[model samples]
Target: RVRLFLDVLAAVAHAHNRLILHRDLKPSNILVTAAGEVKLLDFGIAKLLHDATVPAAATEITKAAGRAFTLQYAAPEQLQDGDVTTATDVYALGVLLYVLLGGVHPTAAFTTAPLDQMRAVIEAEPKRLSDAVLLNSAGGAAAVKLKQARALRGDLDNIVARALKKAPTARYANAALLADDLRRYLNDEPVTARPDAIGYRSAKSLRRHRLGVAAGSVVVLALTVGIGAALWEANEARQQRVQAEGLIEFMLGDLRKKLQPVGRLDVLDAVGAQALAYYAAQDAGRLDADSLGRRARALHLIGEIAERRGSLDEALRVFQRAADSTAELMARYPQDGQRIFDHAQSVYWVGYMARQRGQVPDAEASFRKYQELAQQLTRLDPNKLDWRIETAYAAQNLGVVYLESSRSAQALKAFVETRDAWAGIVEARPEHGFELGNTWGWIAKAREALGEFDAALDAQRTKIDVLRKLPDADKNRIVQRHLAIAASELARLQLALGRYPLAGRAGQDAVDKFEVLVATDRANAEWLAQMTLARVILAEIQLALGERAAASASLDRVAADTVRLRSTDGTRNKWNITLLGSLLLHRLALAESPAPQRQDLEAYLATVESAVSGGKPLDAEQTRIASAVELALGDLLARDAQPAAARGHWQGAAERLQATADRGELPSMTLLAQARLRLGAKAGARSLAQRIEVSLYRHPAYAELRQRLAAAAGAAPGTP
Candidate 1:
């Protein structure tokens, strides 16, 4: 029976790798030939997860004229969210396994009534397999039922129950993991479904070595008559475990907060090493639940320290291990709030590491699980501020993923939710000051992605204001870093709207903060990258203000830093677009002669255009930068008195910009309007400008875009 299940799992795992999901998996959909070959039959409702043709919100199959799922096998998430995820098929597989082993459907008792059946699928916990086997007479006889019950009473019971969990996050992540646990059980190995409890492991070992043990008179364990010595050894190990836990707690809880302001945590390297060595010395299977929990937490701190020190491979390895350990611990005590909370952090960290590695789909899955776990914790205790804060973090992380993927509308929704959650959290606990800045920053990023520059600027200002409210804002490294980032982002939005004066002020503020940080931490690659980015944007603001010498100086100062970052740290820090923009702007600043300089600009623009259009795939941010470079070349052509050619470039750039949805870039829009005017479409230009003015109404930064719009209205065609 397990072999048949494994065959089905292989097919499902293959589909998942191709980003396909079988939304309606059931017995009728799977078939076995008379020759005992397995076949997966139906894919009428299969959902393609990664297809560009499919709408992001339409990942689930349409019921069309009726419901699609076999009510007995539908996962709770599938019923509730109408989403087809990998977990949906795993749930169906679990139901199939349950029926094959226990000879009855797990939901048979309460799912008789049609109305109640849907509710049971969505809300009711399925009956335990052991209990169901005794109650149902689907097997040959009462003796057969009892025999099946005995077989599935322990690890098998846990494995099936985990797959049938009401929350998709609580279930096996995929069919492959579910099959792995079953395989482990068959091979007499410790199955992941159960925690590494001593008694369970000892029983398994005894089963595998019973004859050998009987030959040796219960092996060495029974022959040893010194209970006092065993007690002493146990006591010594308990002492060591307690000491390790205390050390880990201090490092993770209090020391971590302190070190955030101090610098990279090289000081804690020895401490992390000690904790790891202590845990490694013990046999994990013999550790109690508390010791396992301690080990899990220690691994998390070690991963964090490794991440801080720029050891990404080690960090991800430790984080994944911690996550797996925490999952097992949570499985052992599914209802414990502390266990649930610990598991949530582990899931989140694993997702964070995956995102850092650019494995976005894996990150999204882990983040979704983190969100589910957070929601579960919230339901477990609505008034618990810690759990509520975790929910906010969950929303924030999901918004980050959506923003990274260029799903701006969905990202904005998630960021707004995160901001609202933080708002409520701040009102309840004013001491959670750091979150105030970060939440608004996320909202700013989401709005920026949607081309709502005015709204994004407002959010950035709020972030700066809240960051400044920290008691140690000036002295604290983290607070100052956030303040600088907020200010730098504010400057970019201001520049995007053509607000020169405000952009200069914001940009200078960011530069001032960054200069201080860089001076103190010259060896820090991440800080150096961030500081360079601030200067690059500052230079762009300088160019817009026509401060030629200042812009040139700033660009020169950051040129080496930009090169170093792009070569060494680009993948980790992700400021490639801004740095590329800085390079283009610098070239624009130096292009004084018409013919000679125009060739350089044209060639550079062609290269950028090709890169964005088809040469290499880019994230939305880099693609927008390429579009901006096209417009810059048009400006140069217009300045050199090539009116017709300038208009052609401007028209092409305008359409490209529109496709990229970067209408918030006021200079690009100005060029677009001018191009339309040159083409004798005055009304079209006026209408576009009017629509923008309306969209940007009531924002304080609205004046910048409005002024640009007015200039476009007054300008003659081909005027640079």
Candidate 2:
């Protein structure tokens, strides 16, 4: 469907480049040959856009033809007898794309009275292609229908939405630009239509934010002047090894503190290169211990720079070298705990890189080894604050790996241990509240993964409370970021728990804070990107509260911001997933019809399954989200006309959650009970529900599941 649209788009764009507008674009006029070629027919009613050289080639055709274009495919301008331009063709193409992908007209549905057709064309917004597809396919044959809607949900939906803007000036400028966006979507690249770039914009933003001056003024000027001056000073006297070393150290250390914040990564890259080169030429065998130590530190700094630049491969290589150096140093000074600490740090970074790249075994191995070193450090000095905190960090990182890999029970246990460790630190030191806040955030995530929604909400609130304790926290950048993250999390948890008012407050708070961060550092594109995500969350909350217009406006505003953010986003997956997630939520919310008795769960399921199955398999977070949708689908099916169909979806939810249940996660255990109960395995459901009754799960539903199971087991004949 998309390829065919692209083919037609190419033909139209070609005509557009020649100053021709296909004023009437629709499926009938777009013919596809058996040979897979596109033939755009009927430029008979097409207009020639104004050109000074060709006075005869004018859009006076719209006046002469008197709305001669097909009414269903006509743009708002044509329906209103307004000036026709390239945007008219863009709008028609949008309708054509809608028909091709969704198998429905974009605007014809609103004009059942026929006489109101012009009002529908000139003012009524069209149903999003995704929604239209599901609604059109509501007559059964669901799998294929669901698939089509899913395919049109995200970027395709955004593209269509842009093209169908009511105001001509708001639609795509021309067919070529629209085609370019479509091409970007097909290539799995960021589309200009709905851009939230993952890299280029971020570096640009960071450069401006880090430096008071323009990005080029600081980055380019610093690279040339610093590199030239350093090389000149060092080469002027080759014997000045100590002086050269001092100069390099200043660049990496004190000077780095000043320059690094300016976001001129090139300066550090150049300095690191020179420092590494200098050390590479030196005779390590003859070097004093202090010089050797400095060399190791230099490698650590360089590796960190590599990490910050998202060059994890380079970082891992450099960190390994540093670890080797630290290993040799530890051998020389076996009693020096600091040397052990240094090696441990290097190992931790290596593990982090491995985890990020999805090398699970390597990440686990490194984290285990890192945990061992952290333990040894604490054992050597049980009273040391830093060593104990290191131990906590190691455990926390291990929990992240376990959680990501679906070991929820272990992840929860590890996070709880880390939380306790941080809590103890805060109790004794009082100054360590920040680390406690961090631990609580992780705990919230683990709880959520296990389906302990109520507990997750509590943990998230606890995390926010911890962040709120810092003196003048709102004025502190680090605290502000933590608060924003925590508030965003709280908003999501509250929304899941059906606590809209609280969700709204937290969501609004998160959006406000992130916006403030954007203002504080205008060059920091990340802040803006983060703000967009926060706004999406807020919009979801608004939708839940039935503030549809406000929710829609927020989404509309965010659509324009995403383009710039994707460029600066380090790992584009998060922003892309967030955007897609927003679409899914919006579709689900709107799919709730005014039927009074039930939501359009089939539509909801179609949308959810579509999103989860569209491209790459859903990640863990998305899979969890899809599981929730499945559970809802099952719930509806159990009481609906076709009760037996509920079994498959319930079983799916149970099967997906079983891994966590097997690991003894209480929330998953309760969820499994619900699924088992719905599946008519009364004894098994009761057993599972009883097992979770002892947990500290705050929600009454935990115990309610047991009661429901018991009641169902003792019910009237033939309940299943």
Candidate 3:
């Protein structure tokens, strides 16, 4: 089975390398003939990445290709008409692997009806392989025997689950990586698919050594029976002590030192389950303080694993139990600081899970409790730097919840405290550059929310400087992405400050960085998407600086890349493509100013209308893009003397700009004023303009519009 799966993966990997998507991958498509050889068959619905004859638009391609896939074997993306990337093939392979090992399909429950099966493929999470195997085997000849089931329980379960992740980005990057993990499992090496947890490894080790332990127990029991009652009781107590010591030794010495460095937390979960089972089997009256503590710690570890896997309801239940257990331990051992800390940590996770589930009031209450606990811990150990850091983290988490609830003032106060705490930590440990950088980012976000652009810009610059000093490597993709994001933010702040030259430089730097990333990993759709966005930012800066040709070039590149992406993957890039196409049309209108063609104006307006009609909720950045498109269409229509059409577009743009301004975005306020002035509402325009600083009158992007408003208000040209 392993060799056959590996062969299938190799074929999938080859297809991905050629930028080809095997839209239908299933067990039936794989053949094993007489000589124990594996072969992959049937690429009837495969997609070519750069087929010259195929159109660039995904809708056109889909219409031509139609939907031809085996429902049971197809990936969620295939069913939903999403982009069919290499990850889609990985998902199908995961289902195949699941069925091979478990003796039943993971989605068997929903297979009775076609619509139910479709919903299952798109929305349902499959059962873990271990559970599926047990349920399917049930009193019959087990799938691959009982021993194979045991081996598949932990490492194989995690590997299959990862491949079957709902989001394509969350799945294995390609089939080769999935095969590599399987190879590791077959070689008895630690797999990367599972979380690195000491407890889980300990459990596996215990299971492997169970026969030896049982033999020892049998011998001890015989010896105890031969001895008298008093000696027998003493021997039994000593035996229990030995067993507990052995479990602890295996967990800490063998598992922790070995697996923790490799980051295998899923293994720890196995150990934790074994430990919990051991404790549960013991008489409650017989369990000592140490045994109770171990039980609580085991539960905590299991809860953490559940939380990481996004099983929030299960995590909450487990965390609460752990917290209760720890609380009981803390009461018994009043001076045990570790117990107090563990109790607080468990409670904090409970609150975090509540927040994630959107139980706002419950989340607020739990976070407050967590904060109080952390504060108490800090007070008890005033000089403990770890406790102080924990307090700061608690504040930060609380602040995030407050921010989500729109309590900006409270969030800002919490963020300031977090920043101050991290600043002290950085001063004490000069090597804590990453933590310091993150704190600066948090501080900048809070300041920006309060409309303090100057302070936010300074904070953002500090973050960028700190991030730039970090070493760049393939493993540091996250840090590199952060650096790009910081540069983008700096460009936005500079633009808001009316520093056009600085904005252009910052935007171009961001684009350069993203371009490098895309070059390094050309198959990464996410990096490509980000590169497109960086170009969009650069185009915005160019347009604002009156560099029409440069803006057009930037926008043209975005349109071209988006088209290729759509052709390669399907409609996943549709939103971005539509957005870029509209912007390009708008730029062309600007370039042909004084005689902007009516056809071009109508085309631009149609594209913008299509984007709006998509009806998906837009983020602030997307809303700004839509507003800019509207504003451009209005400008073109007005220039062409289409009064009614122009007024409608201007009104739409003004509403969007106003909505953004209401969120305390100062840059949007200026744009709203400009929109009002264009609509001949001089008094309303003047009212909005009065809120901005007079120095902003020098900004070239809106200087003429401001001058026009000034003329209408009977003020001198260029006056604020």
What are the Cα lDDT values of the candidates? 0.70, 0.70, 0.67
* Clash number by candidate, in order: 0, 14, 15
Which candidate would rank higher by TM-score, 1 or 3? 1
Model 3 misplaced regions, further than 4 Å: 1-412, 427-431, 445-453, 468-476, 520-529, 560-623, 632-649, 659-664, 695-701, 710-716
Q: After TM-score superposition, what is the CA distance of residue 191 in candidate 2 from its true location, in Å? A: 54
Provide the TM-score for each candidate, comma-separated.
0.55, 0.49, 0.45
| Candidate 1 lDDT tens digits, 1-720 | 777788888788777655567877888888878997677777877766554576645633343412466677777766665555677888888888888887777775533887677777775556788888898855668888788789888888888987786556556666766777788677654565642234423544554566776676444756432443455455445544554464465555445655545463566777877876776677666666766776787899888777655556678888887877788878888877778988999999999977765556778899999999999998988988888999999988998888776777888899888888888888888877688688889889888766677788888888888888888788878788888999899888877666779889999999899888766644455677788888888887887787887887887778777777655434442434456565765656555433235665576565554544442344455545555566567777888898788777767766755644443444345445545654557776666566555444222223433454456568643222
In model 1, where do residues sit more than 4 Å from their true spots? Answer: 1-225, 241-264, 267-286, 357-361, 447-455, 518-525, 563-570, 573-581, 584-588, 591-619, 628-659, 662-720
Per-residue C-alpha lDDT of model 2 across residues 288-384, encoded as one tens digit per residue: 4545565677788887776555455677787787777777766777656677787788888888877644456678899999999899888888887
Task: Give the Å error, residue 657, model 3.
Answer: 4.0
Error of 2 at 389 (Å): 2.9
lDDT of 3 at 518: 62
